[model samples]
Target: MVNCVVKNWQGEQSGETTLEMPVAKEENAEHIVHRALVRQLHNQRQGTASTKTRAEVRGGGRKPWRQKGTGRARAGSIRSPLWRGGGVIFGPKPKDYNLKMNRKERRLALRTAFISRVEDLIVVENFLDQLTAPKTKEVVNALTRWGIEPEQKVLLIVTDTTPDNLYLSVRNLPNVKLLRHDCLNIYDILYADKIVATSEAITKIQEVYCGE
Candidate 1:
């Protein structure tokens, strides 16, 4: 079991919570993590690149000139690939870039991501709920008190519904990402230098990925 320090809203150490060793193993398969990351990145692509073909371009209905005696190569339409301002040949088309991974692959992937960053994980109790007003300085002070530097990318995982104040407070902070509990994934875990997880967030993560 790994002992994670549980810090309160005031930035003081409240207590310690235990994480199952099976779920917090430090040694993770790099290939699994890499594959999961690649899949995630691939799915994120918008894949909207597109180019018009000869038939799609307008003002191409009529031939440029007489086909039989033209000094240049014979052309059928003004939009022919051979003509100026012509449509592109073999150009890219809009496509779906999403890649799917099975349940087993995804489960292992999330587990790997969490385990790989065991040492950097900070489990904070849910004093964030008490924050009714958005205060950027409050978030900064909390992290500072916890000894977590904010300059590096930090991933904050909260319970199902992140409170309005917490969301607004961290929303515009530089290098800080606020995400809900169930949405945890390999990309954010690996991308972050440190992870600040709420108490409920840990339970949710363990419930979903610890089943493996």
Candidate 2:
């Protein structure tokens, strides 16, 4: 369990909240989190890279020269790895890079990683109505009030019901990543310099992750 301060749109402390997600044990926290991160990154690879071997190359059926050459080395075929424009000796081929982890372990890793960033987590009250139009400047000003710098990377977590105007307002910021509560991932959680989650999103996170 962890306690967090909830700030309003103006960045004033309006209330407080708590997160009670189950995290991994301290002894195995790093290892489990690393495994989860690696699995996610590896699974995203397309694995389309391929190379031809000597046996698979075209025109390799006919030998290039006799076993005992006059002056040059004895060559088996023109597609030999040693020859120019020849097949590759050892090269990459298409393969699945996906890694598997149990659902319980994955959840544990996520909870642990999220909790570890408590100091950088900023919980704010839902201000969906604050944005009347899709203006990037308004979002920047709000972020500045929330103690986030212009150059810092921000991960803004919102509920599914959040208005499109708010999303439009935040989409133009290069350093800010807007994600729904249910779409949270290890990469975004760990990569952001600051995490700003709305109060309702925090509740949704607990309800989604803390329950069986």
Candidate 3:
């Protein structure tokens, strides 16, 4: 059991919580995390880049000049790759850049990443209810109380039970990201310097990831 400090909105230690989720037992767990990051970044590519090839270019129907009578080099097509307005040669085409990741591997990678970052996790009990309104100043004040600097990247993990005000409050804040436990991914976990989670959010994660 990994015991962690649970803090309130004021950054005071409210209690101690244990991480039921499995921790990485391997010393080389970071290698799996790196693979997961690479897979995530690769999967994000749109792969929609396209270019017209010489064969697909139009206006090449008639020969520009006789095959062997032109003073200059004989041109068979106006849209030759050598011409100014010619089609691109060996240009890019739309392709799927999506990388495949095994489901078990992804889960293990996430577990490893969370274990690696467990020290940075701050459990804010009743975080959403702390501030009733969607005020940026209030959010900033809460984070400030938690000793979080303004420019620090934070990932707030919430759950379906969390209020809309919490989402609206932190969306525009600098370097702060909000995600439901269901939507939690390895990218956000690795990108954030600190992760603040509501007790409810922790419960949700435990249900999905701590099942063993």
Candidate 3 residue runs with Cα over 4 Å from true position: none
lDDT tens string, model 2, 1-212?
78999999898999989988889889999999999999999999999999999888888778777887478888878898898878998899999999999988888888889999989999999888888888889889999999999999999999963568978887788999999999889999999999999989999998887665
Clashing pairs in 1: none
Candidate 1, residues 24-68, lDDT tens digits: the string is 233557777777899999998999999999888888887668878
Note the Cα lDDT for every prediction shown: 0.82, 0.89, 0.82
- The TM-score that candidate 2 achieves is 0.92
Error of 2 at 203 (Å): 0.2
Q: State residue 92's C-alpha deviation in candidate 3, in Å.
A: 0.9
The RMSD of every model to the true structure, in order and in angstroms, is: 2.5, 1.8, 1.6
Q: Point out the worst 10-residue segment of candidate 1 by lDDT.
A: 19-28
Model 1, stretches more than 4 Å misplaced?
A: 21-28, 67-74, 160-162
TM-score of 1: 0.87
The residue-level lDDT of candidate 3 at 137 comes to 86
Top-scoring candidate (lDDT): 2
